[model samples]
Target: MTIQFYLNGELRREDAVSPTTTVLDYLRVSAGKTGTKEGCAEGDCGACTIVVVRKNGDDEPLYEAVNSCLLILPQLDGANVVTVEGLARDGHFDPVQTAMVESDGTQCGFCTPGFIMALFALRQGNEKITDGTIHDALAGNLCRCTGYRPIVQAAHQACQDATKDLYGELSPLIPGEGYEHNHQKFFAPQNLSQLAEMRTDYPKAMILAGGTDLGLLFSKDRDPLEAIIYTSSVAELGEIEETKDYLEIGAAVTYTRILPYFERLYPSFATLITRIGSRQIRNVGTIGGNIGTASPIGDTLPCLIALDAMLTLYSKTGSRELPLEDFFIEYRKTDLKPGEFIKSIRIPKLKNKQKFRAYKISKRYDQDISSVIGAYRIEIDGLRVKDIRIAFGGMAEIPKRAVACEGAILDKEWVEDTALKAGLAVTTDFKPLSDHRASKDYRLCVAANLFIRLYRDLTDAEDLMEVVAA
Candidate 1:
């Protein structure tokens, strides 16, 4: 089979006999574009970061930063890609490269290319970049040399040059017919029906999306996955729509696109999303992917359960929607059947009278798994709780709803004594196991304390004097 795509502003094609070949291997060995380094084969490190620019229309292009290590070569069949080596124009360094040189950003240079590519996508058309923006833009790239100050300074400087074109106008790098291989085949289906049919035909095929999680199998586990099926090319899986009652997010939608909607509807959830991964990870990872993985410590699960989100699953048989809470059976297991995939997620819009909050406890503030996560949604009728939903993660074999605690809180008066009592009842709901990140006792304590915090914030006490006096 012949796999072709644009590489470094050139049309490149390769012949591979096996579908197991990864884009990282193809680029370094077959295509000889060594600038895209492979630091941690998993998507954790941004050493393999590259920009995948696809045509939305003739006027505007959609650019996203993705980990090259996890991508199968066939996924790039018709898309245009920009690598670190392609950033320059006419033998001149791009503005980002020039700024990095001026700011003394490159020390060891192993991570330089990845950082440059991240900044290149981040600074594409922006006129000014602030410290916070630079920090967020380069969050995925890790510098072991600890030379972050200069690199951040360089990004800021690159943004100041408004007249300079950091990314020049270039044609899409589409592969040609000259390349041929017999053993491997790549399929990119444009619609959901086509994708479903292909999936039904090949149930054992490896499905590739953002590769944030799937990429780890190759890099860390060193497992070879052949018979690859690429999902990014499917248009139906990436749509986002807002209706009168709910927000619908397609499975292929990236975290960057959906974060703003989640922020507007659920502010507390936005904070949790930021901690799920770095900016680059967010750019490539999808909400559906997070739900599909069904990890015990998945940060989004608790919030999704609290929001009463619905998961829509599609297969060759047909389409069905189920509450997200019911989709998980245990750690790393979901209710999805063979040849079936998640289509989209629907979340209800909260009303003004409703109170909602989410909390994540982790050893580090960002780029770490949750030690314990709690999400609460409550409806208050005057001074009493009309209804309540409480969800928790990292407290059991699966992320679960604390129905016992919810039962205790619903219809109860909004008071400190009641909240404290309800918090204790939550401990009886689940027995968390000890892990390296936290202990069973700590998880229970934090879970209860989070509920108390939420109650206090909602009640709005007149003063701290009452607590002090008591």
Candidate 2:
């Protein structure tokens, strides 16, 4: 079986390549498109950035910049991929490339291709161009020799207008169901029934959503995946069902697809999502994958727990709903049974006088794991704490709620002193470990200080978020 995709506007089919082969290796080794460099095999560096154009449910073209290093060959089975080499058309450079040349955005040119591709996707977006958007778009791509001044200038000059000419005429494809090469099976089911059947048959298959996490095994570790069940192609798993009480997000929904809802419902959580990784990571990363990973420092876990999210786990037998907080059993362990997979996450909407705030404490603003993440959902009645839920990450073996902290502030006056008392109660709730990212004491201190920050934030302080010098 062959995996089919449009590479640089040319149809390409591969049957000999391993399904686990990363797009980076496939492009450089097989396709001989070396313009996309491999500075870091991991997704941290933007050197392997590439533009993937796919259609959404509405049949609208979605131009996304993703890390080629972290994407497998089957993941691009029905999409149009644009590399840096594809930017020039008819002997003329794309506007972004011209802008980069005129603005002197390249130094050694190793990372230039990634930057151009990132900007190429940005230029295709309809979002209003601003300094913040420009920085967010370029955050995934890093350049050492050339400073960001020219890069910023180039973004300002080029991305001010959205372009639809490139790949606009390309039609969407009916997603391929599955592929196999050399006994390695890759299943891409289009519906829930098919997924359930496949899950029951191949219970040990690596379930891939965005593949940002499991792709590491294929890219850096060179692990051989005997079987993979790709979930993104499943229509039901990609739906976003909204009700008056809650928003039900399919487990396969990408972070980029769900950011708009978060921006409207939970702005602070949206801000935190932007920092989960760079735009490249978010373009393909899913919150369900975040919860499944069950990392102590998973940025979305604490926020989802504080918001009281619920999960819909599906299996051949049936589906069961579980609280998001209770799903994590221990460090890097979850309550998922064999043949069971996450179907959707349902997050309840905020009620009257309710406010939510989440803060991610990391060394860098973007593309860094959290040192400590604190999330709060508090309800107030005339300066009195009516109800509150607090959850923290990077503080223990699992993303846990601070019951002691909540008890400290519940039914008390929402004041500085009350916030401080809750902060002190953090000691009773968790005993964080000392790791390379931060010390135990430092984490405790920061976790405590986040309460003060949350207090100030809910009280309508001008400086809601801390400002750092760039």
Candidate 3:
């Protein structure tokens, strides 16, 4: 197959013979662009961050940062890509590079390229970049030197330069010709039918979207996935639509795109989504990828379950929709049949009287796995609970709804006593196992306390004081 795309203002194409060839490998070896470093081969580290520009129409391009390691070679077809080395022109540093150098941002400079590209994507008009924004922008890039203060300063300084938008005139990078590899072949399907047909024909072929999770197979598990199908070029899988009743999020829609919608609908879940990974991971990681991975500790699952989300699965035969909870079967397993792929996630709009909240407890504030996560949705009529849904992750073999706890809180008034009793009832639903991150007892206690906290906040007694003699 011939992979054709724009590469750093140049139209290029490569003949790709093997499906196992990654975009990172193609960039470093074939294109001789080594600025994109390989930190974790998996998407955990943003050392391989690169900007992908897709033509929206004839005006400005739609730019996004993605992990290069997870992408198959064929996915580069019809797209424009920019790497760290491509930022400068005529042997001169771009504003971002100048700022980083002036600010002494690079220590062990391996991760600098990724950071530069991340901040580059974040730059828009003359907007004032806040400290929080800088922190969030570079969250994916890990500096071993821990010298983030200067790097963050560089990001702020770069935004002030007028030359920041010089790259707007640069030509888009495009892939060229056929690539040769070992035995397997890669396919870049353009339409949904082509993707479905390919999947139907090759059920065992590894489906690659934003390689956030699938990339881990190469680094951590060391699994050899030769036959590959890249979904990045499929236009239909990337659509997002919002109607009066539900929001339909396509399977390939990245977390960065969905964050704003989730924030508008369920504000509480936004915090958890922001901390799912780093900005680079979130930029490339799809909600569908998280659901497809079927990890018990995935931060999004509990929240989605609490919101009563539904998933649409499509195959060559037809499409089927079911509640998100029904998709999980057991540990590291799902109910998806052969040749079927997740199409989109449909979440109903919250009612006026309903409340939704999500809480995540991790060892560190950012870039860490969850020790335990809890998401809740409750409906109240005057002081009595009309309905409630409680879901938890890292507490069982799968992210599950605590039906017993929900039953205990349903029809009950929002009060401390009711919260306490309901919290205790959660014990009947899950007995969390002890792990290095947290003890079983600690998880249980925290799970119960989260309910109590939610109840206090809902009742407007969150800061209640108790009189004591001291």
- Residue 133 accuracy (lDDT) in model 2: 93
Off by over 4 Å in 1: 55-59, 125-128, 164-185, 459-470
Q: Which stretches of candidate 2 lie over 4 Å from their true place?
A: 161-163, 460-470
How well does model 2 score by local distance difference test?
A: 0.90
Please list the C-alpha lDDT of all candidates, in the order they appear: 0.79, 0.90, 0.81
Per TM-score, the best of the predicted structures is 2
Better of 2 and 3 by lDDT: 2
Model 1, 136-226: lDDT tens per residue? 7777888876769999889988887666452424444443222224533345667799889878987887666777788677656665554
Clashing residue pairs in candidate 2 (N, C-alpha, C atoms within 3 angstroms): none
For 115-201, candidate 2 gives per-residue lDDT tens digits of: 899988999878888889999999998876658889889988887656556663354655689999888999999999999999999
Candidate 3 per-residue C-alpha lDDT over 115-174 given as tens digits, one digit per residue, 9 for 90 to 100: 898878777333358898888877877877677999888988888755445344434444
When 1 and 2 are scored with lDDT, the better candidate is 2
Query: How close is every model to the real structure, measured as TM-score?
Result: 0.91, 0.97, 0.91
Q: 421 in model 1: Cα distance from truth in Å? A: 2.4
For all candidates, the clash counts are 3, 0, 22
Number of clashing residue pairs, candidate 1: 3
